[model samples]
Target chain A: KDDTKKEIMKYYWTSLHTTLANYPSLPTLHERNTLYHYVISSASLFPCGDCSIVSQKLMRKYPPQIGSRKSALTWGCKIHRKFNEEFNLTVPTCDDIAASYIIGS
Target chain B: KDDTKKEIMKYYWTSLHTTLANYPSLPTLHERNTLYHYVISSASLFPCGDCSIVSQKLMRKYPPQIGSRKSALTWGCKIHRKFNEEFNLTVPTCDDIAASYIIGS
Candidate 1:
């Protein structure tokens, strides 16, 4: 169960980062709102109860930044880093979030 | 690029299905709304532009069913099957969505 949970989390984060990395550089207001809602929904509906709670709390502390692709990607990396810190995992650098997530970049 | 997109889609769908499988049997109105928004955001912000467009179209034709775990799971499976069919891939059976996505179920 634990392993599966970990695998699921990996998938979720990878997908999210990749999506953000590919987001429009000059997104419209509606597009930003949509991405914001996606972040909130992810925090609320994530499969792991404990992780969900933690994510919601973290979101409240640092809301998603969806103004642009760079902002969104940075925000995602920050959140992911915080999550890792909370669980005592090795923290990843936020500097290369786009490079890491973007395929064939 | 194609292979990477396929891998990302696989991850996104697996995460989505697993989350739906673990959803509350009798979800609160807020929970239902959250999941609904998640579905909408997914259709809108998915990394693959073509896939996202097709998903948005399908979602408009058949809006997500978030009334309960079973409803949500079945809806997810149906959408996934439809996506596969769109690409001429073998469609999966929806009968065992919960069993398939729910790890150790």
Candidate 2:
């Protein structure tokens, strides 16, 4: 179960980052709002109940930053850093995040 | 650009299927609504503009089915079948969708 959860999360996070990385550098207000809704909805509807709960709480504390592509990417990395800290995983630098998650960077 | 788009879409579809497969068999109204929002938001926000536009049109024609896990899975498979047909790819039966996408079935 734990392994399955990890694999699922891996795909989920990768897809999310890919979307953010490909976002327009200067998104329209509507686009920004749409992405914000997507992030919050994911927190509520993520497949893993425990993870969803955690994400919900975290989102309440620090909502998604969707003003621009760079801001969105940084926000995603920040939330991921928190998750990594909680799990005692290697913490990624912003550069590492860009290099790893952003395609054709 | 095309190859990158394909790779990104692969991850997006895998993550979406994983989420749907793991959705509660019988979800609350709120859960159902959340998933619907996620689907529509995904159609709007997917990184590939052309694909997102196509999905938006498809969604308008045949909205998501979120009543139950089974229904949701079937709806997802049906949409995928349409995309496959458009791309001249192999079509998957419902059983094939279950076998391939649903984990630990």
Best by DockQ: 1
How accurate locally is residue A7 in candidate 1, as Cα lDDT from 0 to 100? 74
Local distance difference test, each candidate: 0.83, 0.79
TM (chain A) per model: 0.90, 0.87
Question: Where does candidate 2 stray beyond 4 Å?
Answer: B103-105
Chain B vs. true chain B: TM-score for each candidate?
0.89, 0.86
**What's the distance in Å from true for residue B3, model 1?**
0.5
DockQ (Cα-based) per candidate? Answer: 0.73, 0.69
lDDT, residue A56, candidate 1: 94
Candidate 2: count the clashes: 0
Model 2 interface DockQ: 0.69
lDDT of 1 by residue, A23-94 (tens): 899999999999999989999988888889988999999999999998888889999999888988778887
Instruction: Report backbone clashes per prediction.
Output: 0, 0
